[model samples]
Target: MLRAEWTKIRTLRSTVITLALVFVIAVGLGVVSLTSVRIAFERGLPLVREDFEPVTDAMVSVLYAQLALAAFGVLVICGEYGGGMIRTSLTAVPSRGRFYAAKIAVCASVALVLSYATVFATFLTAHWTLGKYGPSWSSDGAIRVVLGTPLYLTLLCLFALGVGTLLRHTALALTVVLSFVFVLSPLATVVPGLREVAHYLPDQAGSSIVKVGQQADPVIGPWAGLLVLAAWTAVSLIGGYLVLRGRDA
Candidate 1:
C-alpha cells in the first residue's frame, strides 16, 4: 500500500514541479538575501549588530518556499478527489484506514526528504555567499535550525494534508491553509492583545524552532513551540481521520 501511494505521488508532474520550485526558491532566494546582507554590511549600512541573525537571515526563503510545500500537500489527496481517483483508490485498498495511513506516510516521507534537501542546499548557498557571516554546522543553534527546518516543513505538510482530507477540495483546502498561515497568523502578531494568542499559532510556534536567539516576550521555548505545533498537527490529522472514516469515499 505504501509503495502504491509512493508511486502515485512520484508519477504526478505537478509533484516534480512543486518540489523543484521548493529547492530553487529556497536556495536561490537564500543566496540573494545573504549576498545583499553582505553588501550592506560592507557598505557600512549602520545595521544594528545586536539585531544581526545570520542563520535566520540566510534561510529567510523558507517563508516563501513553505507555500509551495503546502500546495504540494494539498495536491496529494485533493488532486485524487478532484479527478475522481479516490473511488478507485478506495476500491483497490478496501480499508480506508490502511489507505489513509499509507497516504500520510508517503506524504510525510517525501516532504521530509525534500525539505531537508532544500534546507541543506540553502545553508550551503548562504555559507558561500556570506562567507564569515554564515553559520557553520557547529555554530551555536545551527544544528537545531538545520534539523528543525525539515521537521517544521514536514509538520506543515501533514497539517495541510489533514486539512485537504477534511475538505476534499483543492481550492478550498489551499485557501484555508494558506490564509491561516500567511494571513491570519501575521495579522495576529501585529494586532494588540492578539499577539499573545498568535504566539501559540501553528506557524508562529513552529517558527521558534528556526530562530537563533531569544524572542521578545516568548510564549514558549523552541522545543515547547515545536510540541505545540505537533499538537496542532495531531488534532488536524485526527479530525481528518474521523471525517474520512465516516464519509463515503
Candidate 2:
C-alpha cells in the first residue's frame, strides 16, 4: 500500500516541481536574508548582539517555504479527489484506514526528506553568504534547529494532509491552510490578548524548535511547543479519519 502511494506521488509532475521550488526558495531567500543582516551589522545598525539571532535569521525563508510544502500536502489527497481517483483508490484498497495510512506515510516520508534537504541547503547557503556572521554547527542550539526543521515541516505537511482529507477540495483546503498560516495567525499580534492564545498556534508552536534564546514571553518551551503542535496534528488527523470513514469516497 505504501509502495503504491509512493508511486502515485512519484509519478505526479507537481510533486517534483513543488519540491524543487521548496529547495530553491528556501536556499535562495536564506542567502538573501543572511546577507542583508550581515550588511546591516557591518553598517553598525542599532540592533543589539544579544537580541540578534543569526541562526534563525539565516533560515528565515523556512517560513515561506512552508507554504509550498503545505500546498504539496493539500494537493496530495485533494488532487486525487479532484481527478476522481479517490473512488478507484478506495475500490482497490477496500479499507479506507489502510489507504489513508499509506497516503500519510508516503507524504510524510517525502516531506521529511525534502525538508531536511531544504534546511541543509539553506544553512550552507547562509553560511557561505554571511561567512563569520553565520551561526556555526557547533553553536548552541544549532544542531537542534537543523534536526528539528524536518520534524516541524513534516508535522505541518501532515496537518495539511489531514485538512485536505477532511475538506476533499484542493482550492478550499489551500485557502483555509494558507489563511491559517499567513493571515489569521499573524493577526493575533495586533488584536490584543489574542497574542497569548496565538502562541499555541501550530506555526508559532512549531517555530520554537528553530529559535535560539528567549522570545517575547512564549507560553511554552521548545519541546513543549512541539508537543502542542503535535497535538494539533493528531486532532486534525483523527477528525479527517473519522470523516473519511463515515463518508462515501
Candidate 3:
C-alpha cells in the first residue's frame, strides 16, 4: 500500500514541479543573502554586532521557501480529493485506514527527502559564501549550522503534511500553516513578552535547530526547540489520523 502511494506521488508532475521549485527558491534565497552580506562587507557598511544571528537569515529563507513545498505536501493528498481521484484511490484500497496510512507514509517520506536536499544545498552554498570572508567553517557552532538546518527543514515539511491531512482543504491548510509560521509568529514579535512565547511556535522552535547562533532571549536550546516542534507535529499528525478515520471521506 505504501509502495502504491509512492508510485502515485512519483508519477505526478505536480510533485516534480513543486520539488524543483523548492530547490530553486531555497538556493536562490541563500545565494542572494550571501551576496548581500558580501556586498555589505565590500562597501564597509558598519557591521553592527547585531544580535540577529546570521543563521536566522538562512532559517527565514528556508521558512519562506517551504511555503510552496508545504503546499505541495498538502496537495499530495488533498489534491486527489479536489480532483475526485481520492474516490478511485479509496475504491482501490477499500479500507480508508490503509489508504490514509499509505498516503501519510508516502507524503512524509517524499517531503523529508526533497526538503532535506534543498536545505542541505542551501547550507553548503551559504557556508561557502560565508567562508570567503572570515568565520572559518571550523568555527564554533559552524558545523551545527551546516548540518542541523536541513534536518529542521525536513521536520517542518512533515509538520505541514500533518496539517494538510488534518484540514484536507488546500487553501485552508496552507493558510493555517503559513499564518502560524510567518504571519502570526511575526506579529507576535510586536508584543514584548510574546516574543518569547513565539519562540515556542512551530517555525520558531524548529528554527533553533538550524544554527548555533544564540538569541539573547531564545525560548530554548537547539535540541530542545526541535523537540518542541517535533512534539507539535506528532500531536497534529496523530490528531489528523484520528480525524481522518472518524470523519466521512
Best by lDDT: 1
TM-score of every candidate relative to the true structure: 0.95, 0.94, 0.88
Candidate 1 residues lying further than 4 Å off, grouped into runs, are: 46-50, 214-217
Weakest ten-residue segment in model 3 by summed lDDT: 48-57
lDDT of 3 by residue, 170-220 (tens): 788889988987798899878887987888898778777765555533558
Per-candidate local distance difference test = 0.86, 0.85, 0.74
Top TM-score hit: 1
Candidate 1, residues 1-249: lDDT per residue as tens digits? 999989888898987798788988998888777787888777878653666777776678987899899899899899899889999999999888899899999999999999999998888888889888777887678888888878989998899899999999999999999998879998998999998999899888887888876432266777788888899899988888899899997
* Model 1: per-residue Cα lDDT at residue 8: 87
- Please list the residue runs of candidate 3 whose C-alpha ends up more than 4 Å from where it truly belongs after superposition: 47-49, 52-60, 134-136, 214-217
For model 2, where is the 10-residue window of minimal lDDT? 213-222
Instruction: Evaluate model 1: give its TM-score.
Output: 0.95
Model 2 scores a C-alpha lDDT of 0.85
